[model samples]
Target: MDGVDKERVQKIVYEMSKGSKYFENEKRKEATINQKIEDLRAQCVLLTDEQISFYQTVADKRIIDLEASRDLSKTWLHSDMDAFYAAVETLENPSLKGKPLAVGSMSMLCTANYEARKFGVRAAMPGFIARKLCPDLIVVPPNFQKYTYYSELTRKVFSNYDADFIATSLDEAYVNITDICNDKSVSSEQIASELRNTIYEQTGLTCSVGVAPNRLLAKVCSDINKPNGQFILPNDYKAIMTFISSLPIRKVGGIGKVTEHLLRDVLGINTCEQMLQKSAYLCALFSEHSTDFFLSIGLGLGGTDTPQHKLRKSMSCERTFSATEDESALFQKLADIAEALSNDMHEEGLCGRTLTLKLKTSSFEVRTRATSLQTYIHSKEDILAHASKLLKAELPLSLRLMGLRMSQFYDVKPGRHDPMQKTLKNFIIKDASQSTSCSSYSSDQHLRNGANIDPSAAEESCLSKFESGHLMAVCEPEDYQQSNQIAPVKVCRPGNDASGIKDNADECVPQVHADNEGRSNPEESLTNQNGKMLWWIDDYICSVCGAELPQCFIEERQEHSDYHLAEMLQKEESLNNRRGLLQRERPVVSLVGKISPVGDVARKKQKTSKGKFIPIDAFFNRYKKD
Candidate 1:
């Protein structure tokens, strides 16, 4: 798109894809976007002078609040590999250099080389369609293993700059070089140049680097001078504002084609500056979440901190969203994460002496602080007490994510390998984990079905045939939190609105009537249930997992309990497998050596002789001597 004839390529793409399903789907999506834009436009017309004034006031107030939280101390660099997959392919096959090349099959293309891109045969285009755009284009199958090898090579270079750099993908990463710049007394430009040169030297793959005060602008800057180039936006308010004033809205990361159409067609917002000029319209037409991001973009603001943690043999829970410096909100989120972590630890009968608190700044600088206590703790109250102290020490810090990791197990003695090894193998907690490193990381769940909300979305019916079961703590019958009042349970039916299977809901628990045409949104059902939903849940929590499950659903709770037990058993079995392998060689080295199964080993080793049963090893040694 940068240099190619856009109209010609559009015609070629259309000719090649006109009748295809992909084309039709794209058309459908375009129509939907257009319809949504029209709806927004209509709403805009309906807004009176007073309404516009009110929205503008709200927007201005939010802008002031958001600006107060900005941190310009960190210099964020977004390093992007130039045509990563294609470049890797070319590096491996020198003959492919200077030729139009693509890394993918006829079905889809991951990326295209610079030469291919000039012909408008770009990434995400179908390979067959790309061929039409540029008949000379050479398509190749992707080799991820080779790509990963080179990616690691580049990340090794990255570790030198910032060991905690966040690798968003194999070819791109956001690194906060604030400390290095201060320590080395160097400019941000020099660091970006060094990184680019070092990566080129090591892997024969050139990269583009963008240096700015925050991640968003850095990312935009990286794309400006593409193909083995670098761009640095000055870390000054005037410079940042000037740079983004006329920048295209489409250049922003989260603004896709649909959003591009919406803004340009509806609000006449073609640039970041225009977005600010029309903030009132944005606030009026879109959700607060969407408007907040738009306002931030207009002001040249973005997340400077997001926590990237390295979870070891520990239990942790965290969430990521828009960054904020709110004290009460931070404490509340911290408490929630801690509570979830507590439940996970208790499920596995674990307690730790050390608690690590993780905080990522809006600029993505991770600050981890820790506290060690003499006594091990697993309860939510104790975890929160220690973690809150650690968080308080880092007060007035703007954070996008917070996590609590409980480590340094109480049962793990320093010198004891067996217990530690067993614990490592057996107690691999499946709790939510989050981490950040200088290199790329892999993989980043809960099932609460049967939500009680939205009467229109649900169909209610009575389960007259249903027979009630004694269901207090049905998840694990022995694990009940004893109380005089029996709390109700919730039964969840998958692929439907969580059809409440609550037994004795003061009546028959409502069954969501099966609607053949009704669409189900599982994600919507899983969102934070509001205050209204908690009216009947009372003070009760699920006995088995210690999570709040509200009023009961017995059959589903049993399923959850079964799943929990099965997971525990699987971990125990894995530990046994490891110990079994270790024990196999132990008896050969010394008969007196410890065996894993004492009773079974005794049965196998003991044998009756003439009078008394002699030790097996001693008896065998005497025969060999004879």
Candidate 2:
């Protein structure tokens, strides 16, 4: 990395990617971001001096409250293995050391060594592009099992320092060592140095360490000094402020490119210090979650305590391939992913009631369809049956990627060893029998009570608090009569019968249902010619108000959507906020870049690469099981 020509690397990457589909996709995203900036500017102009003053008061009050919440009593350390995957490869084949190297397929790269970094090679970049950057680069297929084994070795070392340390990924972790420091009568710097030495001795891999008063700062600090180094930030408020004042916003976790561009280009906020200078605008424009984060950056505040483990919410599998419109090929790919995901789920002892189908078109646009089922399912047959339905609705198709995610875990684990007893129709329709087989999760009863399966059904939720999407609707709940909210309130299994599970499956039919997003479908009238229903309208109408509005009435539609969202929130309030809270927990389903996977249920996460990484987004938001 020290020898890397950053300018040259960017030039080559740009030249190589310029005419590609991935590049075009990035341009589309850039245009969207530009429009958002323009809209923000427009809103800024609309704000009066009084409004600015009012927002300033609001920002100040929030800042005071945020400041009071800062904790400096503990010391935290973030450890990041240097070029983890690549390092492991080099360690395995010592001869590969000192050569330009990368880990991943020709389609995409997972990571590259420091030597390769000199040639602009890095994680998530396509291997083909990396080849153009450095033909001398040695690309190695990723061996995740090997990586996991080494990760365990490093984690064992981590346990010696902080038993509750959080392993974010195979490569990095956050360890709170306040008690260790206090009991040992040693400083945090000492602890970090010792931890690094111990990890190297245990795993035979070099790592860098960052010691700070909180997890946020520690994570940022860990990256300040690259491969095999350590950076420490003291507990003093002035020292913390001084350290953060000039920090680039992107360098902080959660501040990805879009957030970086929005803060920098529109608000003219390039550093943490400038974030506060524009706090009033931030408070006025962004949600409280986002604004609080921005102000906290200005104040250098971060969580100092160990994060409690959370229940695993989701698991997924995806793949990238050469562009194809062949529906059979697509189904084949879906089948493979289902099998892999089923294996991953079973191996991890997880069964989820919700299944989400993710697809990326050849144009690089991503679309998702999700549904919550009545029973917990992990068998291949169940996953495929549900996923095939979601996929079929999206055809006639051309795609580059596809994925399936399961979430909203059930309390009582259903047996996942059963073969399909009922067809796809059974799952879509109601099951009135005493209960579904614990294994198949569907029965003859389900088939008998079937309703016509609507390929497109009520989407999960529009629960995003993030203000990024251009035409995003409010949490679009279907009208009462058509409402299909199926929160996993209970798990029903066979009363006394057991079932056998198979590792295979099949089903899907193509009937387009209304989507929560207002995105016009190619098959439907985009402008509602002669009052033809818009393809994206929920059940041929607004989900919230049940109005059969024409597509031309965008403003009226948006207002109705907003009112519906407000009304739903009010109803949630009356229900003691439980529905809203649960809905919020489910990530807003959208047609965008890949939905960040919610994490693995077991210790060794199914770390399959989509055969590539798109660093355009930092996804795979992981949650460890308690």
Candidate 3:
């Protein structure tokens, strides 16, 4: 024992003996003295401080020891079971012992035991790759609900000793066990050992206990030992420095691969010691925030105060795409992502207003765009469509990665009068109608899905409809420009149904217009023998209203087809020059809910008398009924 601790023990004993209680109640007084002596003797035996200077190594050491021993005096404790998931799986199926095991879902591995580390298997690695690495590796699916049940049971057991301790996650917690052991006489290590035994007796899993000056050191020390092991670290500078120097720079939390490479490979730094030495340069390289953290870490200075913060405002998950380019493939991938994200949001009972699309180019350049609507979004298609609009506005760049993040969280009160429900309901209804329409579309008509609508034909359709003064352009010039530029498969609601009748329809029926891109196609041009441009706008749109629309509207295009730019232009030019094809009488053709050839129905009907023929009035009556 150090002289100072020895002297303190002597003083306590001497004072207890001098008390009049010794004479009045000799038994009680002697008991008190004996207890004090034992307490001091135990601590002294453990090697009390040899140095007493403030901020000195010995001072820190003694204080840390005091905290540890004091915590031990309490009845409660906290410990984390190492590799709990993999270990439990291996233990229950004894035949799998000593083999690598991981727990996760279809896409990514969640946890892997030490055995898996040998083969470079790790958490977050693709499950297929993990299996490839260790052909016989046991892959266990995560049973989070079951794990949570057991975790609650464990917490209840710990509560019997002290109510203060809490399990932070499924894996860990902190306990304040002050009231149970009451004596304040025994060392904390002895208490820790007893707690360990009690835990093992109740649970098959083993844990490592770290008794230290505070949570920081305690947590760090706990990891020093493996399963079923326990360790402690004195708060002394020398001991802490020795411990830190042995760890890799990356071992310090927040030092990721990029930062590791920046420090180790780029800056020629390999160890914590080297990082500590180049503090100024490192700070300049990273920024003020990172430099301060690393410096504190190097100095063995950790948080002593409790954490205080509000609940998380949002939850998000994202991934980097494995392939770049191929816009169709990118769009499909994004659609899948939208579906997955919407599903997750549904699971969490949340609907967001803001939809953010993040894209990382092949050069690692990141671009993000977000749009906040007045309504909430829940369906995958709606989310993907909005994100697609934004993507189209962005210049086409080879994509290294893309992520869809939904935020602007508004609470979802399932039973309340949610204002966001109106839009979401409309989206659902529209999606359902689109499904039905797509199913009934003729094979030839289906081919037009994702087909580029010709600008001139769209303009002709719009101009002709407006000339009749019944069609109203609901889309602004900007939206028309965007839809036309990207050759989007569908446009938003046209303020009326396909029959041009305005009604309070909740569903937004998309308008399929002529592909404007066909006019710009290399094979099709309005120019004569000379290269002089004949058309101011290669694609036609309503010159007055500018609603670049098709002569006949049809929506629901199949995925994977690039814009049929060539065919759409020929169709547009034919419609614009319809005046050249003389006709005796104009047939009032109601091109709604029926498939008809491009001005070939009359010829076909004449060629075959058996062909079914119907008066134009019948078609108009059918349209009115619909």
Estimate TM-scores for all models.
0.53, 0.66, 0.45
Question: Which digits, one per residue and each the tens of the lDDT, describe model 1 over residues 101-207?
Answer: 99998868999998998999888898888998899999999999999999999999988999878898999999989999999999999999998999999999999
**What is the Cα-based TM-score of model 3?**
0.45
Error of 2 at 441 (Å): 33
Per-model RMSD to reference = 26.0, 20.4, 26.3
Q: Which 10 consecutive positions of candidate 3 have the poorest summed lDDT?
A: 554-563
TM accuracy, model 2 = 0.66
lDDT of 3 by residue, 66-149 (tens): 334432222224578767777667656788778888888545788787787566567777676666566777788987776676
| Candidate 2 lDDT for residue 275 | 84
Candidate 1 Cα RMSD (Å): 26.0
Better of 1 and 2 by TM-score: 2
Q: By lDDT, is 1 or 2 better?
A: 2
* Runs of candidate 1 exceeding 4 Å displacement: 1-3, 309-566, 569-626
Candidate 2 on 100-204: residue-level lDDT in tens?
A: 999998988999999998887889999998998999999999999999999999998898888778989998999989999999999999999999999899888
lDDT comparing candidate 1 with the true structure: 0.64
Best by lDDT, which number? 2
Candidate 2's C-alpha lDDT? 0.65
Q: How does each model score on lDDT? A: 0.64, 0.65, 0.49
